[model samples]
Target: MKKIPVMAAALSAALLSVVMLTTFSGCAKKPKLYLYNWTYYTPDSVLRQFEKENNCEIIYDTFASNEELYAKLLSGGTGYDLVFPSGDYVSIMIKQNMLEKIDKSKLSNLVNIDPMVLQKATYDPKMEYSVPYYFGAAGIAVNTARVPQYEKSWSIFGRSDLQGKMTMLDDMREVLGDALVHLGYSVNTANPAEIAAARDLVNSAWKPNLIKFDAEAFGKGFADEDFWVVQGYAEVVYEEISEEQKKNTAFFIPPEGGPAYIDSMCLLKGAKNVDLAYKFIDFIHRPEIYAEFTDYFGFPATANIPARQLKKVTPYYQAEELTNVELKDDMGENLTLYDDAWLTIRVGD
Candidate 1:
């Protein structure tokens, strides 16, 4: 009486499996918090900890430069819940209404942010559209053991001796900005003539030290003594080196007032899950969490001033270098000029 037909029993099992699969699939999926950030820039442990604590999945993506991030977001329907764009792009996004205004009421951790950093976010003067995350200068990292007679200037990229043993960030603006600084022009220059001159300088002069332009090395080349000089984010090069490597490698902003950049997290205008995005940002601003990030990667955190004061998070550059750093500003309609110039630079024209 208990034995059913074999085919009938198999059919019952298949039905039950379908029901179970459908039940699990129908259950609310983890709220996805899409993050567009710098490639290899965030600590994996920190992201894992956040996911474990919040019971959410962080869908992480990366951009090599602010220009890339802006182009994607500008095309619209990016569906990113949050994005980390540098200071000038943040300003442009704010003006272009590409980001959601910060609801300060939801950000109790706002107090953790250093006023100096927040004040410098001139793109959203009231801190309405963005919150500062990493604050630092974009400059040069040198392996003194390999290139002993280094000048603390962007001019060093032009050194014939460094031929085929150097790399700069793959970003267009970063490359062009350093060339401008080397040429005694401003990083934020909107002048077409100035921008063209910077392009010419890069085309004629800065191309000597060329292994390849890279943004994802994580200072591996520098640490391994592959690149005698690397020009990119200080956070990437500064902390990735070991205690022994620190003896020879040094990070510094040029005295000519090299480009300074601030990276901030902001909600995308068409975010699918705004509340989850806010929660993630709030968690990131927590002093302990922020410390884990900076301590792990040696990045400078602006939101958690306490993190900057942590024993592991020491100062970056000398006082003179710090004083000379300059932030890039929104170029407005003139942004088109830089874009065209960047295209020319890439084409080797």
Candidate 2:
């Protein structure tokens, strides 16, 4: 009787082990690709398709600005396989040795990128460590129904009549860049006098007519009609309003041009999902996939050349309008010039 019970227990234990092994192996977790990107940047549909096709999950995190992204990475944030940073910050990150070398041979779809965009990507023209994702600029979005007679110029912010109803971005580089370009200076100029001029212009001429410098709620303020004129990204302001409101909204890159940026996708130095990162980068440059991304944001196909034809909707602004726009460059230690100027501007009148 004792031997029979012992044998039964052994058989049960063997069956349990096999069952546990089968359950654990069958339910193995899928590989994950971690991304740190701009808020509301990648479209859900595209992410879904990529996840399904690759049988993997994407873990996405967002940062509002390049400074925030850089600060986070520099402070030892890890596990992010890829990041989207503007051209200036890409140069900064490259110098900081926080990025991995991208394998160009794996990115077969890179030929589809616009030659012009490549030429303008002075930060990483050869794309040794980064790939251009989008090239765009922040523009003025005016509510035509409320302010119909305004000129399409950066000077519109200086109008006393539009005071209290106007706002500019809190971003030092962008606001100061607008002022710099308005005065015919290079956006990347490190000349102290020129930077000072830009600073004084904002503090005197522009700040007086503005309600407040805002980056976060300008879109919502525009949609609510609280702000009739807002200097911001076209897609951000457009996404907040109705189709009917869009008819009355005028988004323009001022004639003199302002700061333009090419936000690129870069691989982090210690990323574990190296192969997946390359696959994702190539997948993004595919004409159809690229078109979907631009269409989602109502953005011009400025980077991916062939994707322009594949776009389903009209872009908010034309690629040609970016003609005079200059890419903001890494200032190295010279970034301190803008920092001091911005501090004074932000302290208010």
| Highest TM-score against the true fold, candidate | 2
Which residue ranges in model 1 land beyond 4 Å of their true spot? 1-30, 74-78, 161-164, 196-205, 208-220, 223-226, 235-244, 311-323, 339-349
Report lDDT (CA) for all predictions: 0.79, 0.93
* Error at 144, model 2, angstroms: 0.7
Task: Encode model 2's per-residue lDDT on 1-349: one tens digit a residue.
Answer: 4555888999999999999999887657677899999999999999999999998889999998898998998888888999999999999889889999989999999999898888999988999999999999999999999998989899998899999999999888999999999999999899999999999999899999999999889999999999999999999899899999999999999989899999999999999999989999999999999999999999999999899999999999999899889999998889999999899999843
Candidate RMSDs in order: 4.8, 3.1
Q: Write the per-residue lDDT of candidate 1 for residues 1-349, one digit (tens) a residue.
A: 7998999999999999999988787655757789999887678998998888888888899987787899888786498999999888887887778888889999888888877666666666577888887777777888888888887888888888889888888777778888887777888888778889998887777765578788789388887778889987666676578888888877877888767777889999888899988988898888888888876665555457776555365645533354556678877777788888888767666
The whole-model C-alpha lDDT of candidate 1 against the native structure comes to 0.79
- TM-scores of the candidates in the order shown: 0.78, 0.93
lDDT of 2 at 148: 88
In angstroms, give how far residue 155 of model 1 lies from its true place. 2.8
